[model samples]
Target: AIAEAIFRHLAPRATPLAGRHALVTAGPTHEPIDPVRYLANRSSGRQGYEIAGALAALGARVTLVSGPVDLPAPPGVALRRVETASQMLAACRDALPADIAVCAAAVADWRVAQEATRKIKKAQGAPPPVLALVPNPDILAELSTPGPDRPALVVGFAAETDSVAQHAAAKRARKGCDWIVANDVRPETGIMGGMENEVILITADGAEQWPRMDKRAVATHLAGRIAAFFTAQRSIA
Candidate 1:
């Protein structure tokens, strides 16, 4: 009670998401190649984590399913930590019946077919061992698919190096998600791990291009848009 009161006193803004539930995925999943080796990306989880905070500020019960990232958990948000794509998918399933779902994690496309129980050592003169890869579970697609437990709003992210809008639009349709926040992460852009982002929010109606801004601002804007969506839905229903 004291904590809640303190939080409210700090910012007495209206919480449009009051009594709602939100689920978010963040960070980069680690696909183990060996006991000491793993495949991962440079996703800092900044945007997603900030999104979770934004949603919490709007009075939503936020559950953040995150991977390995060097950041503290957002206050007033429940954090579920996992290391693998499969674990991430399982965590999302366990936190179902959400009002909104954001699939923002940079999950690896594949993992080693077989995980070695012991550490792999380099042979003095022999060739390196071969590693077979298999596709990882598609968490976004699973939740976006039509189902009784599907969230009212499903959002995904696409970090592309080329044809950002085109690829993100195609991905939105392919993944069956309502919105896809697309951004370019080419080497020159410095957006993959940077604090600022220039994103295009692709939806069924059309693409809404957002100007370059801090990730926190983007999250707050997106959260406000989400609140408007729910408000509109309630009116329609």
Candidate 2:
């Protein structure tokens, strides 16, 4: 069938990403305080999972450092499961020298200093429990900070609820990442866990906003851009 021929052609074209190594971080880490109490965020891991799948389809060797998430591993991709930002960082360091590193994980900004081995019992007329919080490493900043063995390209996400584009630009400058995908997570946008997104791609060149589209479309566009960048680099090389 003509459709079958089209599919075959498309499949081979996907091989552009082949022979390349990609590293992606996903999901929100849970920091346990007591046996029951924990600190976490609202990251659904949807975008990161989709990105991993896209990268795998492109024939890249993908190393996905995932936080707590329910998504299955992409075919032909190696996954490292981690529960904390520190663990995730360690995993990434172990992966090493990837062609591209995508920081999609919503890493916790802080963690409780000490975790209670046992759950604290509630007492009548007692004040609320106090938790001492400490800042976690800014993984993206660390990776993009002109380090040794850093990836050729580092992509970070800036999920801002206000001044999305501007903030993303600033974040890219501050973090020194090659690219930042900016999204407005205001409740009405329905971006979180939703299949759709309105995103702006921020880079040293400029900020380019894409019309609202499904996640698959966004992934395809991003993948294409990544491929183009690699191709340009190859030509230069």
Candidate 3:
């Protein structure tokens, strides 16, 4: 903590995000199907972790609510780890009353309606088990809802396989978030588990396509934009 403070103090740019709290959600939720197995995704939590670090560098008090991932917590950021979507939502609620929120986790859309306590054995001649699925909570929409606890700026991510910009724009409207970072995560793009990313930043104004760059670079750029957002708000106030 002391080292982080000193680094922030010596940083070249003024800490525009100082005195603000930022909440970030990262990684992929694991929906348990049985004691030995679970459903999950390919998210490595790199982008979100980088964003947390970048926000802390800008002097924001960051709380990273993460799902199961192998990455370590970012320096000077509080980390809350969870396994399932429900747990992730709870952690996010606990970190609320924040000034900024970035929902970068690729949460599972569904979970087994009834998770088996024991793994089902595959019978030699029987049909495979049919798993019933249920919708998981929409964390982004919940955070974006109009309320006192809602962050001033809420950013959501859209990992689309097709019609990236159009789908992301629709998601922004549907979720009522301030912005959406949309990216094509087609397997061929190597983005889901890769170090680099190319995203389209969708805002109420319009969509801005960013060049492919390292994930850390994307985080830094986004943090700069966030700082500018608060600066502009302060001026208007």
Question: Model-by-model lDDT, in order?
Answer: 0.93, 0.87, 0.95
lDDT of 2 at 213: 92
Clashing residue pairs in candidate 1 (N, C-alpha, C atoms within 3 angstroms): none
Once fitted onto the true fold, the runs of candidate 2 whose alpha carbons sit more than 4 angstroms away are 1-13
Candidate 3 residues lying further than 4 Å off, grouped into runs, are 1-13
10 residues in a row with least lDDT, candidate 3: 4-13
> Clashing pairs in model 3?
none
Candidate 1: which stretches are off by over 4 Å?
1-13
Decide which is better by lDDT, 2 or 3: 3
> Candidate 3 on 170-237: residue-level lDDT in tens?
99999999999999999999998999999999999999999999999999999999999999999999
Q: Flag the better candidate by TM-score, 1 or 2.
A: 1
Pairs that clash in candidate 2: none
Q: How does residue 80 of candidate 2 score in lDDT? A: 93
Model 2, span 24-77: residue lDDT tens: 999998888889988997788878877887887776789999999998987767
Residue range with the least summed lDDT across 10 consecutive positions in model 2:
1-10
On lDDT, who's better, 1 or 2?
1
